[model samples]
Target: MSEIIRRDPRREWIARNRLHPDHASVLAALGVNRGGAAVSEWLGPHGVVRKNPHAIGFIGPNDVKRIDRSGFQQGGQSAATTPVAQDSRRTVTIDQPAFLVAVVPDLTGGRLSAHDKDLLGLARRVADADADQPGAVVAILFGEHKGEGDGELKEQALGDAGIDRVVHLNDEFYAGFAPEARLAALSAVEREMMPRFWLLPDSPLGGADLGRRLALRLGERAATGVWQVEADNEASLGWRCTARGGAGSLDIQRPLPRVALALAECAEPVDETRHAAEQLTLAASIPTTLSRIEDLGQVAVDPAGVALAEAEFILSGGNGVKEWGAFHHAAKVLGATEGASRVAVDDGFMARDRQVGATGTWVTARVYMAVGISGAIQHLQGIQRCDKVVAINLDPGCDIIKRADLAVIGDSTQILAALVTMVEQQRGGQRDAA
Candidate 1:
């Protein structure tokens, strides 16, 4: 990413599609009013922008200029910083020196006047960004409910990493799901779930729009597809968003809480066991609500539980790694877990959970092998912590290459065949020695 793009990649963004989940929802989450109703509910058989008066920005701070004035991680870039959300914002004291948003009542009806009063109030708080850890990593667990473990790993990973706090919303009041459809259905179940963040985990098309509506409704600045998780000496948090390398990366030092999406880079899930029942047991986070709509029947999900997180090494397909059966061979070779991507799932490669990205899983492990993925920003965001990353791509310029320690320019179909044999040979040798 050029330095210029890293700082200001949104020009192409502003000029493009509102249907984009990342950009649209992120800005929406940040308090920009895109102005409209849900596209799916509004658009007719033809695709067209529907202007709806309900379209509004999030609950800006009681002041506007102050927020714009106090900007970025260091609070300098005031050129354009948006508002945060009313998605049940919270301010808690966790013994760490950190800025606090004390949860004020957003009286603005979840709308912001472009550059208004409540906004400036938020800006004034920008200086409070770095309350404790200079480079603290903040993680939020969304789409949660009580009695079930939907946001389990998210909570565990952050905890295992020793991140300050794992925030969970009191309920799914602010879930990215079609709220109008099943508000009551989820509300009862989410009561026990602690959701530090309210998110829309819907499809990419609806995601951006959902975030936008959320920002407008909540009045916060929201950015989606966050690739980097770093803690600098700023307030709130600073995430390496996909916007990095394109537009300058975001330094959300603004008082407005930024809405961010973690890259679910089909990396391995972590296997940190939280001792329960005085015994070591496999820990899993599954959202279970007694009130699920029985009339609708079973919700499709990944029933197979594999030890991807436990693997010392993982070899799998990204958007690439085509030719169906090759996936099975790769997994069998290393006694590894197998999974696919959103594209892979769409093309009948694997189930949904097997798919990875901001909408999927985040993994940190020893070895990462990529075949066929173009290395889009979203795919590579969650993978920085890998001890070693090997990229195999036909396109040499894929973004994944920059992040990879080793690069292999080749086709994964053939590569997988060779790798399977190679891995088996090495494993066989290790076992023989043992």
Candidate 2:
């Protein structure tokens, strides 16, 4: 017998509209008429198809209707589904703030560093502690920023990081290692804004130096290695913080001061809310001071010789790696520090200092690439703070593949050779262009 199916365009559209009032009912109705009352789909209502899997079928042995686990019918292939995109961040605007929480972030390489983002998150916490009299998070950016797109896009980046206001110091005087000029500019900001709390990332060769000098110049006893901060009634600033002392051997809990230096991962980066990062300007011009220090440009340093804990990019090899020379060449071409799994270290393929695991030195690299390394528990623990992990392995089901943001399933030797060739070609092209 030939069966003719009647398609209702209105019902099909309703089935596709998840937010419609009668969407569930329409969807159920459309899904109940397919073969064995299982997989049902509505095709091209408005150039869009929607599928709904149904549990309606012949009763099983247990006298219960058999549920179709697959999106397709018993003998039919399932259509591909496109994931719906959703933006969940709430937009926040602080027109009139009771106070301001000033954050001076070390925009290393003209972008917000991980440590800088963490410090901003901490600042957001401090600013939003008292909702009734909520303060605003004001970020003070120095120098010209790059790689963050145009001016509007750059402000959007700051907005996404929970910055309510931005004070950019992009003058030539503030450029380079001009602590004296920067200190003078910060002093002007303090006088003009009078921010409630001043926060900075306690990172070496970045915010640490400037923060200490700012604290000294202002004569405000600053909290140096602050990791945790909480609102407290007894505290002068209405907050208390836990800081590390004695070379990170002692934990000291005290009242939060006006000026504080925070460690990396002091708090999670702001993700739930977006703010209006409105531009702000200082009323008075900063007077340039005679600098004793000469501004010599950046010195070239080899990435492979950098300490594992401080390395930003790492290329790690494991037991599956067959060609050590190719691995080293890949690391060199990629400009990444060298790291190795416990097995590779034990086999004497990599030095003991290059070992990466819980037993080895903990690494906080921005990008950790593992070639032929099946991720071990200890190795995963060591790179827990890394921003991204790239895995190259023969087995797609390897533990490292599960942790990797990008996984390439192939032979390690071939992958390394290919990567080196690609990098060398790009460099050669760049040289020719120059």
Candidate 3:
């Protein structure tokens, strides 16, 4: 008999740490909008037709049943393995209102039990979709069993939906520790579970940290910028991501349950399925220490009113702008926000959010006219989403022309002056007519 491994990396992770599912929080580390949504388009094999569920997080310790060892503490005066709540660590009733469709690995009396009360509705929604079939079930997978029979009951939930099977794994599930070692196990579980859907978080909790860790756990490609998950079609289970910081939309595919992490970007997380019982389960398994109390209570900062989302026309000043006042002048002329070349920002003429480069935001405004901007690939990747781009530069050999929707061949400073004067003249004529 294979006894469960308590020291498993995944088990250790499940016991400690939590996944951040917001995207905005992830972007904040690099300085982005507090509420702004930066999208990462495609990183995996683009145009590759997939056949698996497309969901992120419909599962957690909450989706299971466990012992109520709530008072247990690390190195406390209490016994090391003391069970406080007499009712804790009891046999879970799958048919009961409390444990329907939840995952409890400790059902047989040894492991973790998690109850995701919040996901009750979501689980029922998924289960109901496949409930018509008795034996067929959606696979609810986890990296470890913390004595909650949640995994076991999830495997038996036939009435709730299809049969719910849980793969009680004890491996590299914890995100903080080394996670590269369990990719194979994750892949193997996913293959067997064959989930029809995948649900994920829509916050700043960047999944990349988990994905990179997951890539180590599962030997497969991991793409970032995922928001929504659909479980209907097996061939089309993936995410609907906004590429280039809301520049455009990207459809990404990842392994079902194989892609688990937090969304730190403040992006709205959506769930098509969760049942009442699921919510009850969350109530049972959720640790009190895992609330958002530690976060900055309520400090809001209004970003520079210049918004890329609503801007119909945009003007960018690059290093070629030469001076800070000149860069300000160009931005003022267009009545647009000031963007910068990476060099200009580093030189202190502009701020980072205004910087354009590969690691920056992607732009796709109607008209994006650049002045004194040398389009480098890093910069190009950001603005490549622009609908129509016009690059004004003295150097015709610049790469902007190759990728721009329209390239203007001239000195940025000279061309800008002429264009502004022409606009002013036109405006004056209109004023005279009035």
Each prediction's Cα lDDT score? Answer: 0.44, 0.86, 0.44
Q: Between candidates 1 and 2, name the one with more favorable TM-score.
A: 2
Per-residue lDDT of candidate 3, residues 1-434 (tens digit): 77862233333233222253543344344232222322212112333322212111123255642222343332212222222455222222234222122221112112211112222223334334444431222323334433323754543332232223344444333222322333344344445443333322222322244345544444543333443334535434322232222333544444334343323332221132221222111112212222222333334322246565445467777778755575566566556655677887788777777766576556656678887777888888878666678888778888887777778887666777777777778889999999
Identify the runs in model 3 with alpha carbons over 4 angstroms from their true place.
1-304, 308-310
TM-scores of the models, in the order given:
0.30, 0.71, 0.31
Q: Rank candidates, TM-score, best first.
A: 2, 3, 1
lDDT of 3: 0.44
> After aligning candidate 1 to the native by TM-score, how far in Å is the CA of 220 from where it should be?
46
Error of 3 at 164 (Å): 45
Global lDDT of model 2: 0.86
Give one digit per residue, the lDDT tens place, for model 1 in 1-434. 55552323353344235566575664454333343323221222233433433232223455432332333432222233234633342323245333322111111122111111122122222223455532222223334423213456434323332233333333444444443323332232234332223333212433345444554554566654433333344545442234222344553322214543322331122222121111111133334435432344335432234555444455657677767677676666555555454577677677776655556666555677766776666567645555678878888887888888888888878877898888789889999999
Off by over 4 Å in 1: 1-304, 307-312, 428-434
TM-score of 2: 0.71
Error of 1 at 341 (Å): 2.7
